[model samples]
Target: MTLAPRLDRQPRSALLTVVMSIGLIYALLPLVWLIISSTKTQESLIGSFGLWFSGPFALFDNIAQVLSYDDGIYARWFLNTFIYVVAGAGGATFLATLAGYGAAKYAFPGKRLVFAIVLGAIAVPGTALAVPTFLMFSELGLTNTMWAIIVPSLISPFGFYLIWVYAAESVPTELLEAARVDGSGELRTFFTISLRLLAPGVVTVALFAIVATWNNYFLPLIMLNDPDLFPLTIGLQQWNLQAVGVGSQPIFNLVITGSLLAIIPIVIAFLLLQRYWQSGLSAGSVKQ
Candidate 1:
């Protein structure tokens, strides 16, 4: 009886491990394939195994073609994306930080109502609002312009929510009280003291806003018709469509390679700035 006691439990454990491994592979397989496929040529993509490289290695060649093709349009797309992220995400983070701090620290009439609206807004999906946003922008004649993308990006409900919670917990009330006693203005205290402590949360929110703006395809696709104003996501999709279109030149390798290259900057940013996130999350945990 003792010898046969645990056979069923062992099978369940083994099954769970197997299922988790399969799930991980399912999630990571596409990324692995992208890395492999980027090394291939267009013909090799159609004729060769997808998960492995075939034909002469063309990673650098594909990158060169992607950069040099279409009058260096991809470069413009990169620059556009950079500008959008900086202006849009940067503004959103600034607004969210101040609003969240105010919500957490100040007492004002209708404050709870305002937060209620913001929380309700957080539950609303961006895609669902895209149509209304587009129509509103169209009326304002902001369509087909960079502002269409940037304006919407500057209104991040989720960022506001995150910083609200972070500011409440991470910012010390004692520090603010002391600053007030020293006759420091609210703006001075925010910029000098609170902002320093809010570092981890600020970095976290900025990273989120940047990623959202960077990967936003639907918004830009709906708002801007000009190919020159396209971000990398829309630009890549356009290339993808042209590849599949009748009698169009197939540049599958360049498209795939461009995508892989497009993501590297975000990855680099996260890697370099994550240290601040750790410190921010740890802020105001201890008091004298």
Candidate 2:
């Protein structure tokens, strides 16, 4: 008889490893360049190789300039970004959790129609709605205001869908019924029992919403004309643009430093919440 193939044998394992290694390097190149570029002084930044440090280290100097330039407007932008993420992302997470739980557990009139609408909305890119949203906000006199940015960000279709799927699978119907039979009111049962079970899913959705709101650029660009109301994304972009026009003052160092600062909070959030995200992904993997 012909020899049987070994159970541990894998064809193309080396090829797969090589491909993944290349992808990892490709993904990291820009971030590495940004870090190296941020450490260089303005003159050195323009003259030196992008991926390596050159001359004296100016990372601390660049950070100080980024925070203090234009009468400390960057601090205001940082505060504004914090507000947007707290209000917009926090509200989105809360609302999506409620809606997703209700949709998964309750039978209501027009439920299917509502799901259909949400699915359609998810399929439509946010850019496609930006013009209409701007026009509507303009009519309502909300443009150039923080409300313009925060309001639209409060709706997250993808977060809703993720929670819906997670909740449906992770929460047991019998447990809910048992709580109801024990004379617990719906809200009480949900708060005491269901919410605990849904922690991973909720945290997963919250992270998604937070990241989306934090990185939001296009809607804020169209909605807010006031630099005072700018988030870090818009504020950094303004600094980048200053280098373009006539009589331009290129503050590339500030822009690079500010970008690095903006990335820190998001990275920390992911690091802190990754356990919940991973648990949510693997929730139903094993059968009891």
Candidate 3:
């Protein structure tokens, strides 16, 4: 008989492994339930056991209904989410990269104050700024518009900070001096040289910003009043509200299925981008 690895020599390591395995199961249990629940019909979902398959398989049916419901509003929400993530996260990443690289490399006045302010912003809760932002945007007539979502998401203190710390160490001054000596402009040097080296940090920041924008609820809830402009977070919430109302057509199945589908893109994005992130990190680790 094959023997298990000896744990007597490292009890703490074995204990930690056991604890982490339990934690992993705990984290994954809800997702497993969601998958099983989503495959069941609305009636079965209500009557059947939550952790196991209870009703007739309605996964495809549920997906079809989710796609077709209310003139396909889910499609619109998906598009809106795509736009918000792309524009908001992309803009934030670009700006963060520029600011971070500049801060790390350049000598300037008030740089410390700028860094301090960014650090302070990181400490402040996002919700604390929501009401004031709403008031300001309301005055500017930007509320209930895509700009409301996109504009605020453009600022990522953590992204900037991450890149700043990373660039200060990962990027070398010698390379930049060489570029300058070769008569390359700042923009050219950044695009051709610095950006490639900063890929991992940039991708990390972009992913963070993308997730924040994708899963954003509170800001969208307060800023937007129109259903047409709602992202998946708000749109799904509206469906949940309708489902819970007295004598309402229970769309619980559709909601669950839609939610499962909604997460696919994000999962795919992470999977697709992870190799690049890893390669960048690996490259960054090498000595110049």
Candidate 4:
């Protein structure tokens, strides 16, 4: 009887292990292919096997060419990405945290209405707002400017919701009351006590904002006509356009290399900040 039960459980465990392994491969396969493909020359990229090494690695050369191409415009795109991610993500995180903390902790008139509006905003797709955003930026004479991108990225409804839920549950009401009793004003208490407690949630929202803004293409594409002001996403699209002709332009190499470079910042940011994400989730679950 003991042997029979053990055998049945073993099959279930074995099946689960296989399923998890398959899922892992499915998730990582494309990334592996990209890494391999980025290391190959144009001839090797076409002639080589899809998943295996078939030529001398040109990783360094490809990177050099990508960085040096078109008077080092790729570097400019990189700088633009840094500006967008830092300003967009950092600003959005701060605003969202304040809004969320206010909604959750304070008892004020029209609070419910404000919360409803935020939820409605979250339900609305970003793409739906792009046209209006373009028109507004155009009217303000901000088209083709960095502000056009940064301004829109600063308002993230989902980010607000994340921090609101986090602040409500992670921050203890008694702590705020005790701080007030100690002669700390609301602003001081928020800056000193609540903000530190909410750091993990803030970091989580910032990461989401960074990724969203970094990958934003349609808005930048529509808002900015200047190729010099393009982010990596739009720049890559331009390379793809150049690659379409059957002549000796040979922009396929640049397109592939640019695509690979575009992914680096997001990957690095995630790897560095993922610990905060873990800490945030755990903090949210802890008993207040």
Candidate that scores best on TM-score: 2
List the lowest-lDDT window of 10 residues for candidate 2. 243-252
Model 1 stretches with alpha carbons more than 4 Å out: 1-20, 278-288
Q: How many residue pairs of model 1 clash at the backbone?
A: 1
Task: Assess each prediction's global lDDT (C-alpha) against the native.
Answer: 0.91, 0.91, 0.90, 0.86
**Model 1 root-mean-square deviation:** 5.1
TM-score per candidate, chains pooled: 0.89, 0.94, 0.92, 0.91
What TM-score quantifies how close candidate 2 is to the native fold? 0.94
Query: Could you give candidate 1's per-residue lDDT for residues 65-119 as a string of tens digits?
Result: 9999999999999999999999999999999999998999899999889889999
Answer with 2 or 3, whichever has the higher TM-score.
2
Write the number of the candidate with greater lDDT, choosing between 1 and 3. Answer: 1
Question: Once all C-alphas are superposed, what RMSD does model 2 give against the true structure?
Answer: 2.4
Candidate 4: residue 145 Cα off by (Å): 1.1
True lDDT of residue 224, candidate 3:
98
Residue-pair clashes per candidate, as listed?
A: 1, 0, 0, 0
- Decide which is better by TM-score, 1 or 4: 4
Q: For model 1, what is the alpha-carbon lDDT of residue 254?
A: 86
lDDT of 2 by residue, 1-288 (tens): 899889998677888899999999999998999999989888898768998878999899999998899999999999999999999999999999998998998899998898898899899999999999999999999999989988998899988887787888888999999988999998998889999999999999999889988999999999988999999999999988886656768688899999999999999999999999999878777877
- Order of quality (lDDT): 1, 2, 3, 4
Per-residue lDDT tens digits for candidate 3, residues 17-66, read 99999999999998898899989998998868889997688899999999
